[model samples]
Target: MEINEVQKWIKSYYGQRGWTDYGPFIRVGFLMEETGEVARAVRSYEIGRDRPDESTPPPEQLKNDLIEEIGDVLGNIALLADLYGITLEEAFTAHKEKLVKRFNS
Candidate 1:
């Protein structure tokens, strides 16, 4: 799925649920919360937690959790981008192109 397609899907999905009514501040707050969840999932998946029960999730389960959390983060990011009137594809490519030039130099 392309970023533009994903962004449109996100917009439509959120547009139906009253999420589009929230201000940028609320959207950003949700984005930050989702980011934190992604970070926590990554840490738990990479390092065995102190709890014995969490030593290691089955590979399938670990992958599922990571995917779900990352999806959440991406959704929130799309919403934030929508709120700011930013096209994720353009923004991502432009920013990445700058890095590409910097590295190639």
Candidate 2:
């Protein structure tokens, strides 16, 4: 799906619950929290944790967890972008331009 469509869905999802007015501070906190989850998921999937207390999840489960956490991170980013009046398309375009300038120069 396109970034704009995802952004609109995020807006609607939160707006339906009266969350459209959440301030930037709170949104950033949410983004950070999701980012941490993404880190943990990556660690578990890539390096396998040392927690013998729990049986290691199946590889498929680990992969699924990683995908889910990453999606959460993306959602939070979209939320932040929406809150700041920035479209993800614009962000992606700028990032692509930066990469091209850095690589093609």
Candidate 3:
């Protein structure tokens, strides 16, 4: 699905979960937490080792962990844009133009 569709899906899913009351700060917090989880998953993937005590998730779990964390990050980011009254399409367009000027020069 496109980014716009993804944003709508996140809103619908969370709204159903009684998460409609959370503010931008709450979404930012979730974004940060999910990012950290993605980092940990990457670390485990990079280290290629597992702990006997299960301090880290096994290698097989790394892929799914990253997927889940990344999805959460995207969902929260969409919520952030929505909270600020910005459409995801407009944000994407502005961001792409910014990148092109910064990198295509």
Candidate 4:
């Protein structure tokens, strides 16, 4: 699904479950934790890289872990946007517009 669709789905799901008070600090903490996980995954990947002679668990595993971390980050971002009453479509559009303006300049 698109980012906007995912955001709407998340907002609706949480809203229905009565999770309306998403604080910025909480989201920040979540992001930090997720970032740590991503770092750990990267470290693991590096360790695997250094052990090419040994039986490696395959690069796909590390890639999957990284993808999971990205998903976690996206989840926290969606929560943050929901807390601020900002839709994903609006955020994406605004950011794209800014990038276009910067590039044109």
Candidate 5:
């Protein structure tokens, strides 16, 4: 459940399936696609979609979809980081330090 564990699992899961041949740019594309899904999930949560042709999912289903999409985004980010030999924990550490400097100054 740690970031390193998750990164290792992502690498193993994809690597076992032979899905680890992506270039950094291609990984970025996958990350972007997952990000768009997250955005759409957020939009659904904030405002119900207008689609009379299809019935809207219940609130619970929408929430689940949002969580899944967010997980997808996280997985993509972890994979991209692993591709570059950086761990998410290290990224978060640097991120927090930057925020602290920017705000506490």
Candidate 6:
């Protein structure tokens, strides 16, 4: 589905569950928590990479943790976009445009 469609679906789902809106603080907290998860995964991977000769976790486990953390980050980003009435595609496009303008200038 499109980004706007996903936002609309999320809004409807939340509305049906009696949640009208999520505050900025709540969204920020979710983002922070998701970032922490990602950081932890990165640290785990780094440790595993640095100590390959030692008893380290399996590569598949590290990969799975990183993927799960990425999913969490995406979930928080989607929640923030829904809370702010913004679409993910719009955000991405705007970001890309800004980067291009900055580099071209």
Winning model by TM-score: 5
Report the C-alpha lDDT of model 6 over 2-103, residue by residue, as the tens digit.
876776775676678755366878878877988998997898887644665756678898889899898677766777787777888899999999999999
State each candidate's clash count: 0, 0, 0, 0, 0, 0
Number of the candidate with higher lDDT, 1 or 2 = 2
What is the lDDT, from 0 to 100, of the residue 61 in candidate 2? 99
Task: Please say which candidate is ahead in TM-score: 4 or 6.
Answer: 6
TM-scores, each model vs. reference: 0.87, 0.92, 0.84, 0.73, 0.95, 0.74
lDDT tens readout by residue for model 2, 1-105: 888999899889978988767788988888889889989988988888988797789999999999999888887788888877899999999999999999999
Deviation of model 1 at 98, angstroms: 1.4
Q: What is the lDDT of candidate 1?
A: 0.85
lDDT by residue (tens digit), candidate 5, 21-62: 888899899999999999998888879777888678899999
lDDT of 4: 0.80
Per residue, candidate 1 scores C-alpha lDDT tens digits across 21-101 of 888888889888888888877877787456865457776777789899999888888888887789898789889999999
Q: Which candidate is the best by lDDT?
A: 5
Predicted structure 1: clash tally: 0
Q: In order, what lDDT does every prediction score?
A: 0.85, 0.88, 0.82, 0.80, 0.90, 0.78
Best-to-worst order by lDDT is: 5, 2, 1, 3, 4, 6
- Per-residue accuracy of model 3 over 1-105 as CA lDDT, tens digit each: 887888899888988997756888888888899889888777778884467866766667788877888887788888888888887899989999999999999
**Where is the poorest 10-residue window by lDDT in model 1?**
47-56
lDDT (Cα, 0-100) at 63 in candidate 5: 98
Q: Model 2: residues >4 Å from true position, as ranges? A: none
As for candidate 3, its clashing pairs are none
Off by over 4 Å in 6: 1-21, 49-55
Q: List the residue pairs that clash in candidate 5.
A: none
Return the number of clashes found in candidate 5: 0
